[model samples]
Target chain A: MNPPLSRRDVLRRLGFVAGMWWAARAEARDIPGDSVYQLRAQLTDQDGRSFELSSLRGQAVLVSMFYSSCEQVCPMIFETIRLTLLALPVADRERVRVMMISFDPARDSVAVLKATAEAHQCDARWALLRAEDAEVRRIAAVLGVQYRRLASGEFNHSSAIELLDTEGRIAARTGTLGAADPGFVKAVRKALSRQA
Target chain B: MALEIVRRATRIVVCAAAACGTAMAADFITVPGGRFASVLPQGPVPTVSVPVEVAAFAMRATPVTAGEFLAFVRAHPEWQRGRAPAIFADRRYLVDWRSPVLLADGGAADRPVINVSWFAARAYCESERARLPTWLEWEYTAAADETRRDARADPQWRRRILSWYERPATTSPPRVGGAPNVFGVSDLHGVVWEWVDDFNALFIAGDSRVQGDPDTAKFCGAGALSVIDRDSYAVLMRIALLSSLSAADTTGSLGFRCVRPGGERP
Candidate 1:
């Protein structure tokens, strides 16, 4: 019952099939051995755009975890990361991106995340993401960030800035907060330079 | 001679069938949860035993065996020794195996699978639609003995568990057939060190004294958690071992089992 295929029709069908194949291949490439991209967690950014953690590949990332309700150390975390980025050269800064994941995902919805992003003066280069409670725990485990929720609706957590290379490998980590550690900044610069 | 040959063939067929049955069935026992006092104190005080309210759940009757893990890897190649990503497992993962997918000659199929990273164990549990028990759940279930539900308060019970820890780590572990505890669960102690979901949360602080320093900024909220019941050496030893490990780190004697939510069948 099928019609005889013309050359134009045949080429059109072949192109469509090839396009689909390419798309699937690109989506399913093998992740690197040392990359944290292997973790499967769904995240929604401050802009309410949903994405996987693996989608941040191909760009060096400065990652950390914090909660919106945290008044003392959390704000310092944002400031500390901001200063760390400022320490880098302008060109290198443009090459490196930043991601802040919330450990208190139940309270930090997209609207709250958007407000926090604005308060921190976060530009497009930065992403404030929220995930479910279990996914948050998994992300914290992968990053070696420790946290525990208290009875008072507050959280006690270890603060660290992890530098992830383009492939999502943790190249360097520093627990020094409230100020930028020069050595960590240098590592970030080196990771960015390596990407180029 | 023909009769002897037939008998040998029959024995082989029976053994193969039994192995197949075990591979298909992983026994799980229901644990009725309740208000339990844990050796680890909640909040900052060390004087009171933190009352933890645990919900009912089902736990594997025994630690996952080498045969089960091998079959799991065969079904999901991504978790095999060399094939798994380094971020999820260290180089020592399944190093004792004969190859990436095969067990060595002396590695018994029923022995608890060891040298597995937490991530690998978690993935295996996820494949079964289950998960590693939280530290509280494991601690609560482990507090029981064959006759009594809360045998942890008995000195003899504590001594028995501590004796297992005193044994040299170099010795080969026995098979996963330890006597069942009060909950009808086996191998909760005296077998292998199992991974809990919240191992990192156990010892987030290196020491309680460090909380006063500016470096304490590393930890938010109520600084580092201090020990409540310092006399529970067996539980403390477990916490120390777990605290020293990263998720990707594996050990020669470390293994894990899965737990399902209450009333869920597996």
Candidate 2:
């Protein structure tokens, strides 16, 4: 006693399914073999927007890891990255994006991340993201960042700015804090130029 | 006809018992956690020993065998030898398998499955609703003997573990049937090297061979982590091997098992 689905209805359902399949395939195709986008980490930015690390693929990214509570080295890490970006030509700088992942996800909630972003004056191009502990370890492994939490609830970490090309491959990295490493800045510029 | 029916009933009961035994064999053993001394010292000073507090968890009784891993790959074709991406596993991953989905010949089913990258091992654990044990968890569980919980202090036990490392790597590894330790977990030693979740975190530096100050440039906050307990050679060797590997790197001896937090299982 049920009416048969019309031909038009059948075609519409098939097309919708096919559209979803194609979108997934297209996203996968955008990632390359050597790219760190292969991590497939789920992250939430300062604004509470959930996104995949691979979503940052089409732009040159300056990526690093930090926790908000750290007083000394973490603040220096932010300043160093800012100075490095400033070293770039205005036109090249406008095209670059910056991402800082939190190694301490337990404490860095969305609100804390948002507060930190505002305090640091991170612009629209900057994303302060947090992910689960396992994902944090994976990202740290890929980025060559080392950190260890101590009994006192403070983390002893190495701070560095890693420049990822449009394809998410680490083009260069600099551990020089409190100042911008000129060589790393030049590599960032080259990456931007190639993308353009 | 009556006798035949009884015979069939007996066979069915026997088959059911065997299946139950297999399920029991794969059951995880609970490990009670406590503050314990680790081979790797915690603080900046090498001699200053720090006690690491481990949380209670359950660990697989034995390392995952080839048969178990084959079933995992069959159920999850994406993890098939030839199908997994190079970014997740290298060329040597499951290379000894006869085909992408089949195990090699000669009854190697019970042997521990090696040549697995960290990412592949993680996926396998995830499928079982488990995860790879953290380094501290693995270390705490490993510091046991057949009867005693903390057996690292026994020089004889330390030598026994060290001897396994000295065994030539050329020989084919034995099946996963080693004697259970105090926690009823088996094959923590005298088996393939297991992959811990934080293998990459073992950052041992102070190698004089490097040309420039690569440690300072490569690592950020604290300079470099040198081995604290120089006397604990076995643990130090593990740190060296783990530090040398990347997440995607797979070796012939590297395999893994899964763990679950206490009271998390149904």
Candidate 3:
């Protein structure tokens, strides 16, 4: 006859299984995409001030799509962005700003965005913004962003980042998850050269 | 639209086993040629040799005049606006998608259709199973110089070429005699910037060894293999030129010429 394990022992075993399950399911399905939306909508930040994306006439912007609650890719997305920003000499970094907007506007509040930014120790050059679902959809369509919902309150989405020059014209766009890819760096570098 | 003359030549493909022996002994009207030494190949190139060996193809001697592009519109009217090829609206194509120019050919039937993006040019070429020439091939076939004019040495030609820079964009291509390059290929240089299939392939400020990682010696721009004529005009020949324009850019200065595979023509 064998003795039963204690409550603490059962919880530890469950945690280990959950972690393994999460590990196995990393990099899951992709969101559907056909046409890219023509970027036109305006964006706002956690500070409550909004920047009309199309109106920011002469500033180069490095933009990505994300939500604060994401587990698999969003955090990794932030880290990737941080590294890319770090790679740029301070002069270039100051000239170019990074933007991340929450695709899941309903779930992510301004507070949530702030907390996420704080966790990453994000800088002034970077902004986390929130928007209405309809506006987000419009922006997404223009940027050709694709995202799908997950049962766990998260989402599966595309990893492309767009580079826009001072005139708000798209200088270059990379279909990569973040700044982690060398191709992303090269593309960004190329776009930066086109920047006025 | 009927103003310019393209000296339309029937497309001739000499390679087919059927045509090889019976092909006409074509006289390559080698006019006074120029020493575009830079245009010539150095060591070797990937797709084709450098100075471009355009075997010769049957092309409408004159460009598809403004009238030709116009008929394309009046017939398949639906294909005129939205259904038109993607390149027509490309920043490369100078044609305005919303308000296209009205030409004698309907709308630029004779006037070279400037402002055509590479995509638009490609779509036009593909609709008929043709394709745009590589830069080298286009230059080789069009450049005329039997009398041996050095493009750099001839002040008149040099000024004409530089006029493209710092000039307002216009749909009115240069007059036939005025725009032709040193080669007899009319409007090769100044009328409007022409489209090529491999649009993003090179950069004036770039190097060929771009596939590898960032080694200081590699992409660091130190002694980057100078493209043939690096000593002459700087930006016009720069590989990274396209990288400078907006993706939505379309100006009257842009146009295109076509090339076929194996340098053959139908």
Where in model 1 is the C-alpha error above 4 Å? A1-9, A12-30, B1-23, B44-48, B204-215
lDDT of 3 by residue, B1-266 (tens): 33323322222332442333212222122332222333323333321224322344433233434444444444435335444433124423434434543542334444666554444455455544566665445445444333433445566645656666657765476543343334445555555566554333232324445423222221211212234454335234423454343323356656665545543544
Segments in model 3 whose C-alpha atoms lie over 4 Å from true places: A1-196, B1-62, B74-79, B82-108, B149-156, B163-171, B175-184, B206-225, B234-248, B262-265
> What's chain A's TM-score in each predicted model?
0.90, 0.89, 0.70
Best by lDDT: 1
lDDT by residue (A64-103, candidate 1, tens digit) is 9999999878998899999999999888877778899998
lDDT of 3 at A76: 68
Q: What is the TM-score of chain B in candidate 2?
A: 0.85
> Relative to the true structure, how large is the alpha-carbon lDDT of every model?
0.85, 0.82, 0.51
Fraction of true contacts retained by every candidate, in order, equals: 0.60, 0.35, 0.00
Would you give the TM-score of chain B in model 3?
0.58
Worst 10 residues of 2 chain A by lDDT: A149-158
**Candidate 3: lDDT of B81?**
43
Residue B181 lDDT in model 3? 38
DockQ, computed on Cα atoms, for candidate 3: 0.02
Better candidate by DockQ, 1 or 3: 1
| Residue lDDT tens for model 2, A1-196 | 9899999999999999999999999888767666889888899999999978887787899999989998767888889888988998988877889999998899999999999999998999999999998889888877777677655566656777899999888899887887889999999988888885
In model 2, the clashing pairs are A157-B221, A158-B220, A158-B221, A159-B220
**Candidate 1 chain A vs. true chain A: TM-score?**
0.90
